[model samples]
Target: MASSTPQSVERALAMFDAVADAPGPVGAKELARRVGCSLSTAYHLLGALTARGHLTRTAQGYVPGPRVPALHRGYQRHLGVGAGVGELLVRLRRATGAQAYYTVYRGGLITVVDSTAPVSDTAEPFVPGPEIRAHATAHGKALLAGLPRPVRRRYLDEHGMARFTDRTITAADRFEAELARVRGQGFAVSVGEADPAYTCLAVALPGPRGDGSVHALSVSLATAEFRGRRGAIRGAVARAAAELVPEG
Candidate 1:
């Protein structure tokens, strides 16, 4: 049986979808009516999701969170850039035998927009939310490298390179150099430092605008499996990006 907390969360999720699927913003009263819940219950749920950036209020009513559209774009990026990016990730995950992730730049931070973990002993899923190391993760580095040089310097200066593991690169200059190389190679790699015995392979995806801003995707897995299949993993991610990215 599902716990009460999960049940409440599920109902809240339904309420958000009901409001979001509407043609335009929906009023709390109408939303509650549509959700078949009391007005108070509806407001409470909306307030919670809104607080967490999963929903937002508008003059018209309430709408999906900003993250929602970006997530949609990441999944469907192969078809067109408007939305549906999650579907692409699903396909990539199935093809790659590793965990796949999508991220977008938000408030100068790289937020994990979505992810899919392979069903295997080698796969270890990182709980999705805000990434602990936006500066260290392969997706984070890909996004960072796409930034202007000056902005990159400022970020490094402000967040002063912190180490996650023995192998994590913490020197600002070295990391800057690594970013330059990533830009040249068109992909990023993180080995065994972000998490012990795991490696991440990532690539920055071009957006609709010609600017450096990007949508990034990465595949992560245990070190041994990652090393054994690195070439294939890299090729799969590259192909997915080529298919999904508007510029590609």
Candidate 2:
């Protein structure tokens, strides 16, 4: 059985998501309605978040705080242009003619650290969400499969596999089997799993200083286009990962 999520943490995260999705600063009453909590509870949580610098209050209402930008800067510093991953992403994009992304698994979250793609008028750029769907994305699966077995099991128990598309692996046993395959293959591929229109291929990057953390490189393209050149795309991605991340 999956462990229950703490209500307070759930509520706080819901409120934060509401604030992030809003076009402008949100007042307490509106936030309460969005989070399905009482106005007082919303106010209390908002106050706490604001004090902790997760949010900022203004004449309009509450907006994301300075801490948000500071955190982003810190994340970039952790994986900066000097890290050579940026240039690797550019090369991957050129090699595959698809959007190339560098993703890292940190604090139990899969974050897209950088991406490179063509400047096309027709193609919409891929925007990664704040909460990664680990069971669906190729990079997410590659990263998850790299974790220690116990830690990976704990993560799946805490965050139950939520299905995003019909192709998403929802059964725990089946997902475990998929991770095992990824470990054996040294790469991962997803076909219309996260989004029906896109296919993604990814390979795990070397862990930082041999720590157990997970990082990966991925390329995403339209399903039909990916099908026509799957082998070439996979080879390019694997070669890039191998060249950029040194052997431990």
Candidate 3:
């Protein structure tokens, strides 16, 4: 957000984001540190969140509350996601033994609405509104590849290709070439480019009948694990995506 945003509102939102990005339940002390707020401010903000049903206190720490899923389900419904999509994502995770992500391109940005457990230290957080460039994550790139040239150019213009690693494609011409390969290969891939420890593969899924939303299926694993079984992982994601096309 910009400087005009209220300081308390910014801190509270940042605290919530820290909780969402956390691997497990987080304590108020850690939340304060992450958001650069004082301990008392953290407690007050956490209490507000708990009272509003945005967070739940647990034996270990605080985690997402029931309101989070309710909001998420409503978002998915607006995206035209049908039943069994969550089950399909779980199955993809079981079959591939990697983190599975379900994403949709909405409001000219790619957003991950659901994801499975992480297997390692590799975290390629692609959720928009956090200053993350679309080019830094495989799912974003895959969705971008589905966009028309003029639209893609406008997106890149609005959000510059901020590099996360040396391997990331920052140049306009190079990224265009990369999108060509994604089209030819029928999938998009990131190898130690977004995050040095993670490798991701994604396949775009056609939107539902009469719906023009951009969607994709993705799996992320440690770079070392992706060494030899890349094809198998790709197939797993492809099969999952195929399962959705017929229902749409």
C-alpha root-mean-square deviation, each candidate: 10.5, 5.1, 4.0
TM-score for all predictions?
A: 0.64, 0.69, 0.76
TM-score of 3: 0.76
Best by lDDT: 3
Per-model CA lDDT versus the true structure: 0.75, 0.80, 0.81
Which regions of candidate 2 are displaced past 4 Å? 1-70, 79-82, 117-129, 208-211, 246-248
Residue 2 in candidate 3, Cα distance off native in Å: 5.9
Off by over 4 Å in 1: 1-82, 118-125, 208-212, 246-248
How good is model 2 by TM-score? 0.69
Error of 1 at 220 (Å): 0.6
Counting clashing residue pairs in each candidate, in order, gives: 11, 0, 0
Report the candidate with higher TM-score, 1 versus 3. Answer: 3
lDDT of 2 by residue, 36-115 (tens): 88988888889889998988988888898878877766666664323677788889899999999877776666677777
Please list all clashing residue pairs in model 2, or write none if there are none: none
Task: State the lDDT of candidate 1 residue by residue for 31-107, as single tens digits.
Answer: 78775888888888889989987788988788888777665555445423444566887888889878788776544
